[model samples]
Target: MRTGFFTHADCSRHEMGGWHPECPERLQAIQDQLIASRIDPFLQHREAPPASLEDIGRVHTQSAIARIRDHIPSPSEHYYSLDGDTFLNPFSWDAALHAAGAAIAATDAVVKGELANAFCAVRPPGHHATPTESMGFCLFNNVAIAARRALDVHGLERVAIVDFDVHHGNGTEAAFVGEDRVLMVSFFQHPFYPYSGTSDIGAHAVNVSVPAYSGGDQVRQLVTQNWLPALHAHRPQMIFVSAGFDAHREDDMGQLGLVEADYAWLTQQIMTIADQYAQGRIVSSLEGGYNLSALGRSVAAHLKVLAGLD
Candidate 1:
């Protein structure tokens, strides 16, 4: 069995502007780090396909998809905003679709037993976008989309989405609130951007909102206490992760301080669950990580764990 790596060149094409933190270079940093660390040699690579309307319809409303597609500009210059932080450029439409599609394909591969697990390395990160609106430099909520696809298309009875991003997965929570058969657990800096996952949205939402500068201990506690218990109870058939490294101290995007070992430990924990209840079935995608060095190192460590090479 091999771990699948999913990405696309168009992900590099989707840039907001020259000064944006969510630049195309983020993917390059990750790719270079994976090769330099020699972690890229042991994985199965796949080109990400564009997600179709039916696939995206699993998570986003048709109107939202229509609005996004209608906003695509002619190859020169185009701009639109669902929020001040998230913007669309000329190639953003294609990039966003591919980012989403990578997650969908990875989910299918893992659930169908085509691969042991998968990782999507594409960009224009999702997980902040809700069903009706996009926010937080996110447009499609990739993990949620994969979860929904697993349940709907693969006919899986139960699935779990674990988001370890520094910020709460508000969009994922919103998408799955009160929805049985899907369990979402997340921990993020409280009073953070798009702050809404703290309180109970309904019966299905489990949030462990932490404060800033709270580092590995709090995160470890959440995983061991809040996440593991719920996961054991749910007995998910598959697991999906919104793997974000922006919580690192070097990353000013979020205030929480996490490091490479933290990410490796988190991946180890989740992979254990996948091995136990889900037959080692897992699909992870990159979410947030700003500082180039920290982001690359953290992601390389994570992939090392994912590929069982660490």
Candidate 2:
């Protein structure tokens, strides 16, 4: 089987504002990189379908869903702010639904043996939107919902989620706080935006807060010392990843100094863990990455590892 690549044009239509960092061009950058790297033809590709409200309800509250739908602006209107950072434009709701749906679909495909693994290239990136609130450019917790789906729909006993976003995946942690079926491991730049993962580490959550200006060596140490041990102990039946590239040194969004090689190494580590415990089942979804060139190159490196073309 091959790796499945999931995305949609609607994902590029969701606009927060003219100057917002989480613009629609993020998707285009990924698509362009896949073609440029000659990685496009090695995988199965599919257009993401809109997620049913029920799929999102697995990880988000009913009220949160209602509010996000209500926040969608009419085509005539320009934008509606969820907070100072996150906002909704004309196509925001459609894009959010599809972004989330991409995760669920990727999970399904990997679980059913239709693909060796999958990568979701849709956005606005998820990882900060909590179970009852939307924040940090995330409309819904896509990876969390996908994890829950693996447990609920696929009848998987245990699943692991690893997030390497520059910012902490507070939303994903919130969704699995007391849940034993899912284990979440993450590394993020602390003292940063939407800061909450610094404290209240959950039993099933291993959140490592790297200080600002840290380098790839520091990140690799944390993953080797902390994340790998927990993953081996848990022995998850499936693995999901919140693949964020905003930690690249060139990205102004965060202070971390991760390069494409760092991302490639991380993906290789995750693949090792998945091969050991999850029958090589892995689903990775895009989270955050702003600098177009870095994001594109980082994603290409990541997919290269996943696609075994490295």
* Best prediction by TM-score: 2
- Expressed as tens digits, the lDDT of each residue in 149-178 for candidate 1 is 999888999998988888888888888877
* Model 2 TM-score on a 0 to 1 scale: 0.98
Write one digit per residue (lDDT tens) for candidate 2, span 84-111.
8999888888998999999999999899
lDDT of each: 0.87, 0.92
TM-scores vs. true structure, each candidate? 0.97, 0.98
Highest lDDT: give the candidate number: 2
lDDT of 1 at 189: 87
lDDT of 2 at 206: 88
